[model samples]
Target: MLRSLDVLLLIFLLVTAIGVVCTKDLLGAAIIFSAYSFTMAIVWQQLGAPDLALTEAAVGAGVTTVLFLIAISRTVRREDE
Candidate 1:
């Protein structure tokens, strides 16, 4: 059912959001954040906003994730140093 799917997506979104916050590794956090963004895009689609969903998928999940990963790759963690 659509309602069940919406609930599942919401639950996944919550889990990913918490994963992003609780993750200690920068790379892992970025990955989780991307998942969160992707779930948000699905939610937008379910809400009948395809344009916003497309933008969120492209910018939020795609571009921002890549940028975060690039920034993470260039930086050295204090623990590593």
Candidate 2:
């Protein structure tokens, strides 16, 4: 069961990473990146590194995502102009 979960999480991480890269919209990419970071945090926890997991979750998923979103929000889209 644990092995299966690990595989599932790995797949999810790959998919989210691809999604982030393939997305044309900055907002979509930021959201997908956050998902990827969150999955990485879970992977770290599974590897028995709780400190790393916490840092990844806090910095990668939380602060980084928020910063990306804020930057995206402040930008003017060419289509809108």
Each model's lDDT comes to: 0.91, 0.89
**What would the per-residue lDDT of candidate 1 be over residues 1-81, giving only the tens digit for each residue?**
569899999999999999988888878889899999999999999989999999999999999999998888899532245
Task: Give the TM-score (vs. native) of candidate 2.
Answer: 0.87
- Candidate 2: give the clashing pairs: none
Model 2 lDDT tens row, 11-78: 99999999987888777889899999999999999889999999999999999999988888898422
Predicted structure 2: lDDT: 0.89
For every candidate in turn, the CA RMSD to the true structure comes to 2.3, 2.7
Lowest summed-lDDT stretch of 10 residues in model 1? 72-81
